[model samples]
Target chain A: MIGLYLTAPYLVYLVIVYAVPIIQGFRISVLDYVYAAPGASVPQPFVGLKNYRKALSDPLLRRSFLNILEFLAINVPLTVILGMTLAAVLAKLSRMKTFFRSAFFVPYVTASIAVIGVWYFLFSQGGLIDHVLGSWAPNPSWLVNSKLAMVVIALEVTWKQLGFYVLLYLAGVLLIPDSLYEAASIDGAGPVRQFRAITVPALRNITILVTTLALIVGANLFAEPYLLTGGGGPNGATMSPALLIYQKGVEQGEPGVGAAIGVLLTLFILLVAGAGAGARRLVQAREAA
Target chain B: MRNGQYGRTLRRLTTYGFVTLGALASIFPLYYMVVGSLQLRADSAFSGLIPKAGNLGLQNYRDVNKAISLLPSLGNSAIFTLGTVVLTIVVGLPAGYALARLRFPGKPAVAGGLILVLVLPFQVMMIPLYILAVRDYGLADNYLGMILPFAVNPAAVLIFRQFFISLPDELFDAAHIDGAGEVRTLLLVAAPLTKPAILTASVITFIGPWNEFLWPFLITKKHSMQPLAVSLGEYVSTNAATAANPYGVILAGACVLAVPVIALFLVAQRYFTSAALGSGVKE
Candidate 1:
């Protein structure tokens, strides 16, 4: 009793700070509410799945979902490949390993606003990229063009995240015993062949881990496109589900709809995360067996 | 054998070249940001990798300061980030210790729940949490509003727990024989051994709060309450015209925001590298 009392402040803090918001969030999803008309009335008629249906059927919402799917499809593989290659190379360096690692990871630590700012300049018309390209051809506004806008945003996310993936891959690669490489070398297996046969296979689990985590995060894309294209510019070309919820809830003052989108997004993320965890466990189990 | 050695040297050279090139590509934008930030507004059009002498000036910093309260926003960020780090470490350490060391009931359930929390995306809860913060808690537009939601990151807890679990049981047995209670044991004996994990957790939590944009942007509307990220966003948005978009000032802000974490990581670079690698491996 004394121990519980002593720790009561911490427990209360967690319950109030962490748990209540989640519970309240769910409750608000069921209740039809608007932020604009505060203190309008209580018992604000529960509108069971109406908000969810609206969120699901809305064309803007559907487009946002499609945009996220497109982002995942394009960015995931590129990040994984780039990260693995960099990690593999870095792992071999006998000197300057720390410098290279820090350099790569620097972008990950920098503010997203700063990253977007730099990228905006790079991708803008008559900016760095355009300046380089204009010597050969006419320049187009990267952010204005819908297709190009998506690509630019994807590139920004990849830049920020690739370092993290490199770190993960380095960890995965370092775990493989050097004896395997030595044995492969003794067998006259060249570097490329050894990497393909041993390194790739050994890194299978980490690859899956990275891919699944990236997929989950990629689907929640918000800040890059939001900053780049000004929150789904030029006919909502790059809007994600997360941004859609923000728009509905904050911008449009429709809390219920926003909450509904939040619930759906949560469900989608959970489903993917659960599948990934299960798959990882199965792989581990099989390997152990 | 000579041909084989030549081929091996060629492969090594290619690997080194590729790695260097990749690092350069990764670091270039950041380099551009820094170089551009030092340039005068008129010279913002310079497309080169380096900033020239005349163009390199502190005018952008002056303009940024005059235009936006960059310092205050930085202070707000520090306050929020520091608060988050302290709260997370304090709350997380004990819970993590208990879950790791104690033969408590429902141990697996607690551990599993923490892992699930780690993988769960905060985007899903953003709207609902915002409403709750505003309505129920009255935390909207307040410092606590931003700090509280992030006070207990499950990832930090999990990492701490994992580190604690790896400690030898003999330490706890010795502490018990010395008549030290669990709390004392954690604070005195266990914690000293878990510094690496604690530092790693602190670094991660600090970075998350420091660079966080969406939550702060959503929760806080007042300019004074905004962090550096939110302020920078507003600065770019509002001053898109008449300001020449001082890349130098923006980069200065970026550097200001980035330097502390970068330095912390550099100081603890070994721990960070190990933690980054270690966390990916299975228990």
Candidate 2:
């Protein structure tokens, strides 16, 4: 009775805010629900699987998903690798550890739009990157070019989020007993060998955690493209599925398509999370064996 | 011994080298933003990687404030973030304590549901929430709509639950012996013991709403009602009037949005690192 009493408020909140919205979202996605405009009457007919089918078939939606995939391919690996490397380096430091950790984390803590502002100037025409590159580079328009814009967004995101994953990785690194490293050193193992043998194996769980997190963050690539490239940029090059959902749902008045896109994005995130969890179980089982 | 000294020196050099370089890369953008904000000239947008003494001023900040409603937006951010922190602590603590201490029948299921909430993205639930807040409740332009959805955070609950579970049972038993009710025992004992947990949860909770753009942006369509994040997003992307001092104004806007959080982080730096390092990531 006490447990139920204590948990009731949170349960109520979850039901209203989270559970209800998700169910409503599923319902909206299957209907032809254009948002009702101010002082206008509109009919929202139940369209069954039409929105999902449209999302699957629509070229822009497909392209948006593809764009996010490309982004994930670059972002997830880069964030995890850079975060892992930096964490390993920071973990070894005996002096000024807090300084470097705090410095890296500043970007992570800052609002995305704020940092996006900083990055926009950095990569725009006659900006720092262009000023450095000079006229030797042909039209060094980072945000203008489709491929390069995606790369820049990835770099910005990786830079911002790297510190967070670093903290997580650092936690994983600290969990490994020092005695193992001492034993490895006594056996004539070098730093690289010790890192590979001890640090990597010990970080199996954390690696999964970081990758899963990075995948989720990468998939929800909205504000960067929205702020930097003006919501999809030149010819919808950097249009992430999240941005697409917003554009179609809110801005363009097609909430059904937006909800359909949301449903798909959730499934993709769940798939990645499931795989990460499964992989962790497999690794742990193997370790036990 | 000589070889060991050499190896140690090399290791130290590599460590400092990588760490310093990474830190510099991390801080360079922020440095540039501040410097660019100070230097108002359009031509010399980035006045060298090293900022000149003469090229700095406070006018652009004033201009940004004039151009957009920076102070009001920041005020909105503060209210929203503070409300979230308060609500998270108020609602999460009891639930977390229950999960930790009480003999709940559906404890395992509740715990699983909390973890599921952590994994689920906000984007997944955006559409329905937007409609509900706007259509059913007519809370589109209100702070309550923005604060309510995120008030009961699963992560805060999980953090508090972990902290409460690790507390000595004797304290609670002693409270019971003194005939203190559950509420009083929780208020007097468990609550006070959770300072570190509170700080951790507060910081974590603060960062989300403080930096959140999408939901606030969606709900509060009116510019005056928007938070700093949404306001900055609008100013940078769409505001045409600020194009006169584009770099300076935009950077100034960025600075306003970032400075508060950055200042808070700097002041409470010790709490952050220790909290993250020591207690987190057991799961």
Candidate 3:
């Protein structure tokens, strides 16, 4: 009972913040939450999945979803591989370990919104990156190139976030006992062999954790695309679901449709998380077998 | 032995070389943002990569300060971000302690509910939250509205719970013997020892709203109340033509906004890394 008393504040907050809004989110999804003029009462009539049906057929919405798919197709593998590789190498270092760790982490620690402007400046016409690429630079530039725009967004996301996953993997890598590696070397195993046989197997749970984190991040991406692409520019080539939600719900004054997108995005995230958990279990069970 | 020594030297050099390259890539944009902020407008594109020392000036910084009401917007971000950090810790600490230390019914239900909530994205709840606060409460144009939804942070709650659980049971038992209740025990015994959790929670929570664009942008359209990130965002997207050098002016504001966050990280980074390890939560 004392525990209940102590936890009362959170319970109340949970209802007001999470539970009520979540329920209201579902409610708004099914109703036409037409924007009313101030001090005017508007009755929201039930639309019965009209918003969802519209969402299914909406090309821009469809484009947004496809954009994110292409985004993760580039982002996920790059983040995981680079993160693991950096962590593995850093774990073996004795000199300037602190310096390397802090230096790598600075970008992740800095706000993406703050540094995204720098990416814009760099990638703009005849900017640092364009100047560096010389004649090989895309004619309209990378940020504006419909073909290469999403790739730039993904790479920007990777550059800003690689440190975070590196730190996570580094933590996991450190927990593998030095004895395992020493034993591997006694059998004349090289560093690559030791890493594969010893480090990889020991860090399975963290790897799963890292992959799920990367996936969740991929699913919810907003700030970079919003800023870097200047609000999904050059024909919505860089649009993300979060930006779409903002446009429909807040900007476009169609809360019902926005809520529908929100509902779909949430469902997608839940499904991905569930699938990730299942994969981890399957891997664990296989090891047990 | 000489061959072995040479091979080991080569391997170590390879490791250092790889890490340094990654670190340089990581840090360059920030360095460029600050350096570029100082470069004269005419110097851009012509001298983009290696900044000339003599040509750099504080003109862009001054221009940005004037361009977006940088000082006032900075104050708004400070208030908004600080308000969020304080409320998150205050509300999260007690709930986390109760979950970890106190015996209660429905504990499993609460835990599971927390997990369900964890998987939830803020984008999912953002609509109704906007409705609830902006429509129902009429808190549009208010910092409190911008701060509230994020205040009851699930990550902070989880971080605190995980931190409290790791504390030995003996501390709580002694507090109990001294006639301290659960809340009192947390206040006197646990809060002091949980600096790491507090710092980690503050770091993550502070970054989200301090740097968030959408919520504050939705809540308050008033220039005085808009956070620096939103103002800078508007500048980035729409208002670039107002400045002499749009690139430098925009980056100047970004640099100002980033200074405090990066400074805090530099000062307390060990707490950040160790705390993330301890809590299993991300910013």
Candidate 4:
């Protein structure tokens, strides 16, 4: 068919690059594969889940996974709430709406490299942040502090992702018929009451979409922590699973274990996404009932 | 009535206050990066939040330009990003068209697969991709190696498919009645209507590779062959010690890497928000 002919190139590409590599990655994970080792000319031998077992047992990996959960806990709600509030405010504005929207979106457009640089200068010893807050906190060395480093990373991610989430929320906000708000106002509902009643319910699907997207993006947190803390802070505090996989697999020359970590991370994302979708469905069905 | 008017005015003022503060928080880092980069080495951290007028200079930028092999890295980024964009449009367009217009075997499977691929992280495929590009085919340090995997972008495909699906079938049938072949009709007719789709896909695709760090770092071994994202990372991390003014030089480097991306976003800003909306894709 003409359709198959048109699709052939892309199907070939997906097979070669995406699908094949995914399958091959599993194969490599199960084998004692070190592609870069000296005289690793022979095919790797099958080790049968040993690499996975080792990755599961790795204290550093466990710590990294725990770090992701902590990040998710703080980041997901903050992003949604902040994003929604900003979108609502922007929607209601009669003046400087475009200016404010563009201003808020600058961070999302800027690359992580530049963004992290500014943050580094801000949080470093004797920097502007320290100069300002030195009296109260007394020179908070952000990158070195284990707990504080993770918190800062979460803040950085939230700031970076806020704009995209805002755009999504704005689109959802625009779809809510103004009549609903008008109706609420006629009933003597204040701004707060109208927002609570009309805005929240109108944004149900968008909220689910944004939250799920946030979860996936949170799980893939690599750039900020990697750039900010040189991949891990003191005591492996700021380490993320993606960072851990890159460190062990690529930096440390243990591809087998790295592939295993990748596999686990994939499964973890699937499980989270599945749970989110199921929860959305249940909530929807309940509301329908 | 006067009291009620005063309360409403007060509420409006507070809302503006909150929005301005949030916007300032969002943009403060970028402002700092620019101001800090322009300041003298000794004056870098000592200055207040607003940069002093007299101390600003381009010395740090000149120093960064000299220190890192910036031109080559930028050129590499250009090649890598431009190559991915062209390839995505070329390959993704036809496939999208096929799914939207032409009847095909296994259509549902392919559509489902595309969505499934969207959910999976690139990290899952990265191991084999690394080996395949680096060792098996000897594409390490080559632009093709860096560009090929990302070129087959699912997001672009989905965007294009969404656009093409909305087009009237009569248009394609008209072309066909005139004895125009599928590729000709596609090139002349179907693809032209998708300017918004093209812009959205190109901008989104451009941003990914332009600011990409990990895979390019993995693929290109030599510093000379590296893209801006990778080289910028290395220069900031390891070579920060070598510069006379670490903050100034590194911030300058960040500026160099960010300027083009920011400019592109500014130019295409209108198209970006509206086009995604037009296509019925929610960001």
Error of 4 at B237 (Å): 2.0
Q: What is the TM-score of chain B alone in each candidate?
A: 0.91, 0.92, 0.92, 0.90
Evaluate every candidate with DockQ and list the scores: 0.50, 0.65, 0.66, 0.61
Sorted into a CAPRI-style docking class, model 1 comes out as medium
Q: Quote each prediction's TM-score.
A: 0.92, 0.94, 0.94, 0.94
Question: What's the lDDT for candidate 2?
Answer: 0.82
Per-residue lDDT tens digits of candidate 3, residues B1-283?
9999999999999988999999999898898998888887734464556778776789988888877888899899999999998888877778888888778987776777677677567788778898888877788889898887777677778888888889998988999999997778877898899987888888877777887887888788888899998898887878876777988888888899899888988887777673464364543
Candidate 4 lDDT tens digits, B78-154: 99999999999999989999888888897887777777777667777777788887877678889999997788678
Which CAPRI level is candidate 3? medium
lDDT of 2 by residue, A1-289 (tens): 7788888888888877888889999999999986774546778899999989988887777677677677778887887677778888898898999899899889988989889888887887778887777775336388988768888898888889888878888877877889999999999999889988988778766777767666777667889988898788767788888788888888888889889989998887777678768877897799899
- Chain A accuracy of model 4 expressed as TM-score: 0.92
lDDT of 4 by residue, A193-260 (tens): 98889888887777777666666666677777787887777688988888888887888888899899
Residue B67: error of model 1 in Å?
Answer: 1.7
Clashes of each: 4, 0, 0, 0
Q: Write the per-residue lDDT of candidate 1 for residues B1-283, one digit (tens) a residue.
A: 9997998899889988988898898888878877777767534354456667766777777777777777898899999999999888887877777777776555565556566556666777787678777776778778888997788766677777788778888988999999998778877998788878877888877778888888998889888899888888777666655666555566666666666777776776676664544552343
- How does each model score on lDDT? 0.76, 0.82, 0.81, 0.82
Best by DockQ: 3
Which segments of candidate 2 are over 4 A away from where they belong? A37-43, A135-140, A273-289, B43-47, B240-242, B274-282
Model 1 chain B: lowest-lDDT 10 consecutive positions: B274-283
The C-alpha local distance difference test score for the whole of candidate 4 amounts to: 0.82
